[model samples]
Target: MFQLSLATVSHGAVASIPLILVAPFALLLLLIATMPLTPPRVKHLWEHYYPHIAIGLGLVVAAYYLWRVEGGGTVIGHTAHEYFSFISLIGALYVVAGGIHIKVKGESTPVVNVAFLAVGAVLANFIGTTGASMVMIRPWIRLNKIRISAFHIVFFIFVVSNVGGALTPIGDPPLFLGYLRGVPFFWLLDHVIGQWIVTLVALLVAFYVFDRRSFARMPVRLRHESEAPDTWRFDGMMNVLFLGVIIAAVFLPDYWFLREIVMLGAAVASYRLTPKDVHLENHFSFGPIKEVAFLFIGIFATMMPALNYLEQHGHEFGFERAPAYYFASGGLSAVLDNAPTYVNFLKLAEVSASTGGGGESTPAAEHAAVHQLLADRPELVIAVSLGAVFFGAMTYIGNGPNFMVKSIAESAGVRVPSFFGYIGRYSLPILLPILAVCGWIFLH
Candidate 1:
């Protein structure tokens, strides 16, 4: 394995090394720079596309630098493989939204233990929270087609998009990191359910408050649309089978490559075997998923240096002095991407503590024993995971599905808020307060 010298990586303070710390803002600038080059019809496209593109470019540049200059000892292919694996996983889930699972009752509420809940629960663990969000949100909105308030959409984004999927390994990236780090798959059940409950309750409260207002304001004489064919109706069930193949690729990739390829081959064959009206009717465009995957590729690549430095020396910067590390890491993660954020903090915790079993950490230390302590202190994993997954709802760019939701909502002619406007109006007022409670309940 290749490693950069801690001395070399940390030589510049977080602020001085622009790629490590300032890259996100720089990337945003590049996006702004490129907007005039895009066509007017696609002006809307730039708004949704630019941040992600900048993030991906930044990641690529960072990865290239580490490989060539730092002798970071990682192959480009290895990193790219890891990078696109996330994209593919995200794409597969994006394609089969329901395969990721989200429960809804009467288009607005979700009941525990019902079939939809069961599907959502299963998919949330299998694909990811965002994957589940993309699949469920559209259907959910359509189910409540009569509801016209924007707050309803905003609330749905809050609960289903952010809070609901924090529990299982596949539900969120941070938890997946925990699973990779030897935390038992079911560990979240014991540690995170309380936090999840608080989030769900907050969602329910927001739903009731908003739903009542929306119902009252709904027009008394709603127009029925022209006699267009129902999109929900399908001639081919094979698309569902293809979606299933994608899910298999997600949770059990090795198995998917092995015997599961046979299943995938069968699913594709079914696609050809099915009628054109069915498969082509809902031809899944690569646009939304591609935008997210590509953009995040840049973010992960560019942020590597920052992540390395933070892991080696973050405690010296007074993270331990603030209750805000949980929020800070996660808040930055909303823009920077959470996978690396979780790793950075996990490494920081590892470096700051003395080795003891259970969730306890000793005073800060300079020795490798701190790494051992981090290895042992799995409870800290809960905090890191919770922080990354939950706080991702802080902004539209926080996670991929968020941008997708925004795009879909806009395409449907629903008025959405601007980036800052979104935070001020929708996320801050509704989601951030809930996140604050979650942080207190989970961290304090």
Candidate 2:
């Protein structure tokens, strides 16, 4: 094994990594952030052709890195492993959760909306935010069809689609990335449950107030001449069984490779056994998961050298305080994909933490490796984890499911806000202030 070290690599090594190697990645990210928000025609062009652009740019970076750098092949191997696990879990959850259907007969009253959102929030843990959002959004939207408003979907993104995923690895991509980096599967239960509770409660309270005010002006009318169902019934319930097995797979025996195999098997079982009608009703398609995997391919490949650069000289980009990691990881997450953003910051924290000597101030004192910092300097990982997952609601592009929810709603005739309108009207006004309070209370 070729170990990575600053002393061995040297300051010249950092300089040797040309600025050009990172340009394609920078361009791809900038395009992702901007293309959809730009004029429609140009946006269409980018969307249609983004794969070609990313692939070409990725080949450029990969070819040069393999040619010029030592241990470059190892970087590719690690990125490949990370990408495989990350995408597999996401794909499995998407397929399996799609098979479980929520059927409700109710009006979307203030209380009903709250209960629905609350259930979705809790459910986000078992099935991922994307899965939960996919299964729940349609029924919720239908129940509220008579009096649906923009605030409904936005708040859905805030709580169920993003913030609620804080508690589990299966719940969100960023947390799953943390799990891949040796953070324990159940780590968030001890470290983040309180923060998750406070944030969810505050948002739910705000939602109740806002939703009730919306309710007052609107007439209470059910779309059909029927009373609400006494209890919700689920179709294709066997997927729920499969989901449990998949969750257990992550921590079962600590065999990393088996975990992926188990998850893939669960997905296959769900698809094979679940009723076809259930999938059709859930609008289950490979499109969203396929898009995620495709874009992340470029991200994983192009990010290797950047991560290596950070590993060799990460301490230079100082984030000494705990809050710095929280805010920076979160801020980038708002614009960039949160998964890579999470990994980038985690690597930064780990490398920076690695250089620290013992508190005893002795030359012979024990040094910490990046992996062990989870226990030694727990605050750092907690903040980074929270920020990446929670702040994903900051924009439609923050997480994969955000845009999917918006698209699903729009497809169903609900008018969603434009990308910039989403940030300016809702996220900036609603989410930012609450995040500030959270930062002050928890992060600082």
Candidate 2 Cα misplacement greater than 4 A, ranges: 1-15, 220-231, 252-256, 356-368
Q: Write the per-residue lDDT of candidate 1 for residues 1-444, one digit (tens) a residue.
A: 334323222222222233334455345434533453367867788766666567656655655556454333342333454455555555555555422222233333223112333354345655577766666556555656555356655665566666666777667766655444444556777777887777777766666766655555655443223112233432444446665565454455333244344434544455456565433333345566666666656655654555445545555655542236677767765664566676667666655553221121111122233335445664565667777877777777565566667766776667777777777887777777787877776677
lDDT of 2 by residue, 1-444 (tens): 233332212122322456557677778787777787788899889878877877777778778667766555545666677788888888999999899888876566677778878888888998989989998899888777767889889999999899999899889998887876677787888888888888888888888998888767664454332235535778988888888888888776535678889989999989999888998998888888877877878888887656655666678887777888988989998998888888778777876777642122111111234347776678888888888998999999888899889989999999888888888998998888888788778867
Tell me how many clashing residue pairs each candidate has.
14, 0
What are the runs in model 1 whose C-alpha is more than 4 Å off? 1-4, 7-77, 98-123, 173-184, 217-283, 321-323, 354-376
Give the Cα error of residue 32 in candidate 2, in Å.
Answer: 1.8
Candidate 2's error at 333, in angstroms?
Answer: 0.6
Q: TM-score for every candidate vs. truth?
A: 0.70, 0.90
